[model samples]
Target: MPAGGAAAGLVAGAATFVLMPFERVMPPLADGLPDRALWPSVILVAVLAATVFVAVWRTGEPAQGFVALLCAGAVGCAVIAALGDAAWLLFPDRMPDIVPLNAGPPPVRHALSRMEAQDAYVAAIVWGGLLVAVLAAVIRPVTRRRTAALRTLTFAFAALTSVAAAAGGKSEAVLAALAAIVCGMLTPATAARAGLPDRPASTAAGD
Candidate 1:
């Protein structure tokens, strides 16, 4: 159960970290709704924290692995966000070149300067690594058959919502709703295999 919970936590933490930068950059869907833009990322963090808490309480053990995973996630996100922010700081004048949308003539397209392009490339690589981690976590055996299936489904939904929040460029309300659904589906099982009492097999009667 510890192993399974840790794996889930790691994946969730990675997703949260990788998507942090994009969340920061994404603007509110409308005026007077600044908090909506941050709901998805906030929900992810809250869910991860709750998962760690459950793992610790049910297993009656400290979730060191989960803690370490969260620490790594925080550091990774900070570094990536710093890199992007640095690029913007260094080339403040070139920032406007990287528009989210292009309203120009034919061949309507987004544009980015070399620095912005590099930053975006780095972001993509980070996101790719996170994706691989999430896939591995989903396939790994975490609990008994039934609980494992539920966990897998929950994690998959979380991964999808995080991706949509980061890349879909959709409305904040939509992202928030997706996040809420993922949270709703992520209720951990009460009786994990590790927490269950071991039972002895019955012996044959022909002794």
Candidate 2:
């Protein structure tokens, strides 16, 4: 549990730190309309936090599932930021105000649209979707099933990578990469836990 706690703290702290840069990229609030442009990213982080708690509480393998999800989310943000513009036309009005659809030169409009899409991807789908799956994985714990944890992380990365590529750079590749790192840390912990000796309460206490 202590190891799981450490993993959770590390991933959450890292995610919060990473999200700080977003303040500069966010859209301005208008008449307190809630700034729909920023809601996705916010939702992503919130979901991640919830997923971390769920993963640790259930599988006792916080390092693998929760941390991997965090890494995937970061990669997702980067991918979306870099490649999202290529497919911006598909979701024309998904995020207003940030797209610059009617307020900029052709290249500038395209760039803004991409930037906005990337931001949304990072905040909403990449982070949000992964977090949701992580929670599902947590709910389905595998105390001695290392493969289940690995499979969860693998599926998340694969799905996000595919989505990012489909969106043509507005993807969550950065988040996916980060998730791989977390998965690496988690896998070993899962394997170790599977081999841990189970002792009776009295015997362990006497030792």
> Could you say which candidate leads in lDDT?
2
Pairs of residues clashing in candidate 1:
none
lDDT of 2 by residue, 1-207 (tens): 324433444444434334443323543332134554365456556656666666666767656455545444533443444333433556555434455467688667756655654554444434533543443344333334554556577566746755774675533554563454355335445543443564444444332
True-vs-predicted CA distance for residue 160, candidate 2, Å: 19
Off by over 4 Å in 2: 1-42, 91-207
Write one digit per residue (lDDT tens) for candidate 1, span 1-207: 334443454455444544543323433232234554365466556656666676567657564335333333433333444455555557655444444445454223223343344454344334433432343343323334444454455455546545654774323323333333233223233223444542322321111
Global Cα RMSD, each model: 12.3, 11.2
TM-score of 1: 0.30
Task: Provide the TM-score for each candidate, comma-separated.
Answer: 0.30, 0.31
